[model samples]
Target: MPSETPYARLTPDLVLDAITACGLWPDGRLLALNSYENRVWQVGLEEARPVIAKFYRPGRWSDAAILEEHAFALELAAAELPVVAPMVFAERTLLHHDGFRYALSPRHGGRAPSLESADQLEWLGRLIARMHSVGARAAFAHRGNVDRDTLIAQPVRSVLASSLFPSSLHDRYRHVVGRIDRLVAARLEAVGPVRRLRLHGDCHPGNVLWTDAGPHFVDLDDARMGPAVQDLWMLAHDERAMEALLEGYASMRDFDHAELALIPALRAMRQVHYAGWIAARWHDPAFPAAFPFAAEPRWWEQHIIDLHEQADELE
Candidate 1:
């Protein structure tokens, strides 16, 4: 594993070999591959059982992050949120190899919800609301200002400064960062203290799946102490779909001014995190094509335009 490669670390044979060594998975064949910050392979066993083996980007995350997810997934499941639970197998104590960390979970059978479906959007909202309710009932407060500053600094210092992207693209992202900074600044001025709780940090469409068990959420590697609204904002970023989600969430709980105020900044932050992550791992074999660079730049540009227009609304 190179220090700078954004790719996942496992090949099909390697993953199958690992599983077979455990003696639980037999005659399993790799069926599909998925990657973002980590690489995940969907494997089909001889018995028709499916499981997902995930190997994280070397040094991008830590063992503690995965442990936090397991703890919170249990909490959320106890509160009736639909989360995919991974079975514990051998050497599962946060195994480390080739400078990367890896973990395994059951393969969820359903696909990510399409934006074209209102029913899916509604289900997403309700699922988020239930997760929020679970967080509200938790004991601790949100962790403050940790990853936010790093995200803001990345484009100007890391991505742009690194020369990994073309000069034209670098300038475009710099402008996006400027716009994001302005929105975040204004939001901080207007929003009051927000209640914080444990969150599934990456709650976007990709992490959500419509399954036989109902709407199931996966990829809890970023789980940490943060605003539940962070999770909600990611799902509700698009206006029409967001409106449906808000309607569903509101059916269960009331929203206050501060939570609403944070949406614009959070949305931009979500994009920033995504762009940095995608750029980091573009060369990885398992990198998903859902938001290719060609499409993502346009999306971020539109976000900047929207942010400029909606700054006052958020304030």
Candidate 2:
């Protein structure tokens, strides 16, 4: 059975009330509600601006993850970096009425880049470096000795164990997975311990926007202290994108060869991670078919296969 709409339980009057309670404009009509995860409306009250109302599911992510995102948004804003600034109505108590958390942010006035533009990529590099300088420090001010073995092993093995790929791409994907597995194993043997750093975690093109201001980053739910390369892996193999992102980052920070090598591994890992996430939500009613990969099973399957193949090629 299809799950109820995110706002199914919420009436127009109640939604208005929620909007009012949150201190956002309550008069504007809800323009769109996607797969029940988030609601977007044009707020005429705020000079006809667009603002998004994001609703959090209970079990999808941890409270720590939410808090971490909150920290990232505020810290980036403080640094004067171009990012979506989220406002929490009640701080720690975002959800007083429902069993979900809520946040409101200005709708970034741009679309996800349909084509890779060098200018945009360059901007991305500069922006990411700035973000890292300011945001990285705060997340790890109080840090822990996060184990590498588990981080690498769990995600990789989970993909293999769960059989996330469709049967059609089994051969192609198997070769790729095998190659990545070998490379990961070799890295473990050679390096012994994996290095750690603060990361945006999900730095995909979908999460980054090209607005009038420049490239603006939106989602930070996956923000955490982990291998820095882990963040790069989220981006697809758009060389222009990588060139722009890396060159921009290099301008501010220095990354060694080891970190560069880890890029391929992290990319492969991220592909597996995302593919698994999609597969898990395949049956979810609330999961919107907003993503390109949603209706394109063959594309997703091939992506996983290609990632592993690239891993093999790297080895």
Candidate 3:
């Protein structure tokens, strides 16, 4: 509970104790996984293979919301999709010990998916479509939706409040963010009312783990409600890439062509959100070490320029 490090109290001993509390015996081997919002680890076990233990960001999600995420992942797994749902130890998924909440999943190994290949993109598109097919079945009562407020406004507010934000470009940052807020809103309005289903919420390439068997969707921690296109846009970079994605997507479910226009808006929102996330987390010790550029005057100045250009594209 240190002011600077969110996971300061989550030492190796605490991580091990948390897992053992779940009735799993640890073998004293822990490999820290690449995660920021949550502390994840590959914990060795006594009688079984290693498991991925994810310690949630304290107070970020209500218990109900976290359960909603766990439920969604279980649903996808039940549907025979390649989602890594939390393991049910003693019929419970959410485990608690030493004042921290965490969940454990059987570890699955895979390298990052090669996004440059059409085969890879299409394969991912189909899996996502099938996942979305399940996502459309029901709505999450606790988890929020993907919208301008969550993606753009809240993050902008966080950035503006940051001491790390370059004072010289403060006004410029505000002006550019304001333009993006308005332009993104207008674009969504013009798209008309589209279906908002449960989404992977953060479906970028990084969240996906690919194997020869296909993609294993990891990290439903960002799970929420959104247009199906929200999940598809992040996987495709260019016009052709998006087309390839949709080609595979269409194989399983229908695509709302209107959602295609929502891409630029989503992209702008994500750009804004990333800056906001860094600013909001700057107080964490890990943030400074991982994103040293946040403290640089030039980075903030260039960020404003980049965001201004993104706002223009949204227009």
TM-score of each: 0.77, 0.74, 0.97
C-alpha positional error of residue 147 in candidate 3 after TM-score superposition, expressed in Å: 1.0
Query: What shift in Å separates residue 198 of candidate 3 from its native position after superposition?
Result: 0.5
Better of 1 and 3 by lDDT: 3
List lDDT for all candidates, in order: 0.64, 0.60, 0.90
RMSD of each: 4.2, 4.8, 1.1
Ordered by TM-score, highest first, the candidates read: 3, 1, 2
lDDT by residue (164-198, candidate 1, tens digit) is 35655656556657766776776766776677766
Clashes of 2: 1
Ranking by lDDT: 3, 1, 2
Q: By TM-score, how accurate is candidate 1?
A: 0.77
Global lDDT of model 3: 0.90
Candidate 3 lDDT, tens digit per residue, 145-216? 888889998999998899998777878988999999999989989999999999999998888887778789
Candidate 3 to truth, TM = 0.97
